[model samples]
Target: MKTIATASMGVTVALSLVGTAPAFAVGGSFHCDRPPIMEVMEQVDGSSALQSIVNQYLVRWEARNATEQCQAYADGRPYDISCMNGRRDWPAILASVPKDYFGRSNESLAAAVRDEKRKGNGLREAMAYCRSVGAIK
Candidate 1:
């Protein structure tokens, strides 16, 4: 009787797993032939050193924002969508910093970037600078 009951439970569990399998397959895909963001940044003339600085800035931004972004996404707020989409522009912000600023410690640079972002100057001003400097097209 115990052996028969065990076999019955195994069959029930297998059926349940099969029924729910499609739920695990949910996610969209993005297809892009262009190089990744960092690679594109590095390919810009005079941007190799700037790319390193941008990487440092991105590491700090991700550390600071990842949790909040994840929570926002979990809550189904559109805010996370905008936030995730905007991340591709961050490298331009780091590149916008005056070259002199690169001499500062990473902490200082990160702080300055955060401050500028808080003041609403980071993305707009940075992208403008990048365009002017030819760091981005």
Candidate 2:
């Protein structure tokens, strides 16, 4: 990683790079932080289990009402967003999805919610996915 001094929005800032390009900018008029959504997407892409959770949600969303869709997503996983181990919460779930699945989809958040409504899978599947992705064990 490398750091560079730059100016933005009338403020001087420091930018940090990963590999060869800048990844984040700090102490600037405009700051870039990794939103939970993007971060979770990265995590999800890296983990089979987390991706399964997202897929499960998508499947359920196709078959149920909004509330039922949300419920089906949880599948009685104990916590609202966590798997058995409690590491993956709603934010983590959001971050775990693959970026390509959402890029330029324009309404991925809503789409993902809708996907969760199409449920056939259950809590066991979700837990298994979580475990597979190493989000839980």
Candidate 3:
């Protein structure tokens, strides 16, 4: 592991790396700092590294949502779609998906969720993925 502190971001990022390149992981939030994530978004889709960044970001968002965004829903109130975790994160997701899986194919966000469910994996798989990154207990 190497410690990197950028002057612009002013945050120290401790990442396990090959040489000095940060190894992206699934289900990580990196303290919600957006630069590293945005940087990865510029990478061409279909790269395994890209997928890891996307997955980890989602899990990180879920962690924040549950601990910090989904309070109303957690209170057992009626489901309010407005506060759903990852509700407005489509760009991040879309930016990281395979080019063919999205832009060229015109995949909508709802359709992607539906496809995940149709494949017999959705929240259940999400929870598992989140756990893989220690985002949740």
Candidate 4:
């Protein structure tokens, strides 16, 4: 019975993943017009170079807005959807992962292989810069 339950739970998780909308990861084939907010946030926040000098509350607010803006861009919604929280006048920054080399069919094999790793870092770098600045600012 325990083994059956474990197998059923695994199946349930797999089904849930299949039913969800496609989310592009770093190495995924899906072209992400916008980065996954949390993934980028983790990268940015994990950076040892960044230090917090601003008020804690304000910092948290900035982080929240950054996350919302990224999510909005990913969902094809207005980038300022999270502006209701505060800082409505600010423009949104949508960080994108460039797939030019891997996305095109005309690329050389070497280029495709070389760009795979860079493509992953592209999202992380862009998102980290945009999102981390807000939190650290």
lDDT for each candidate structure: 0.37, 0.32, 0.36, 0.31
- Residues 1-137, candidate 2, lDDT per residue (tens digit)? 22222232112111111111211111111112432223233444322223334544432332122233234334643323211122234454455445555433324454553454353434345334444433333
- The residue pairs found clashing in candidate 4 are none
Clashing pairs in 3: 27-56
**Top lDDT hit:** 1
Can you give the TM-score per candidate against the true fold?
A: 0.32, 0.20, 0.27, 0.24
Q: Best by TM-score, which number?
A: 1
Model 1 lDDT-worst window of ten = 20-29
Candidate 1 residue-wise lDDT, 12-120, digit = tens: 3342222111111012111123313333243333323333444344433433343343344345553231223334555554665566655565455555545543444
Which portions of model 2 miss their true places by more than 4 Å?
Answer: 1-41, 44-100, 105-109, 124-137
- Estimate the overall C-alpha local distance difference test score of candidate 4: 0.31
Q: Please give the ranking of all candidate structures by lDDT, highest first, separated by commas.
A: 1, 3, 2, 4
Error of 2 at 14 (Å): 32
Q: Which stretches of candidate 4 lie over 4 Å from their true place?
A: 1-54, 81-137
lDDT of 3 by residue, 1-137 (tens): 22222431231122201112222223232233243333433332433333333444444444344443223334544332222322435566455444544332223343553453344413344444444544444
Q: Using TM-score as the measure, name the better of candidate 1 and candidate 2.
A: 1
Instruction: Summarize candidate 4's per-residue lDDT along 12-49 as a digit string, tens digits.
Output: 33422231233233222222233233222232221111
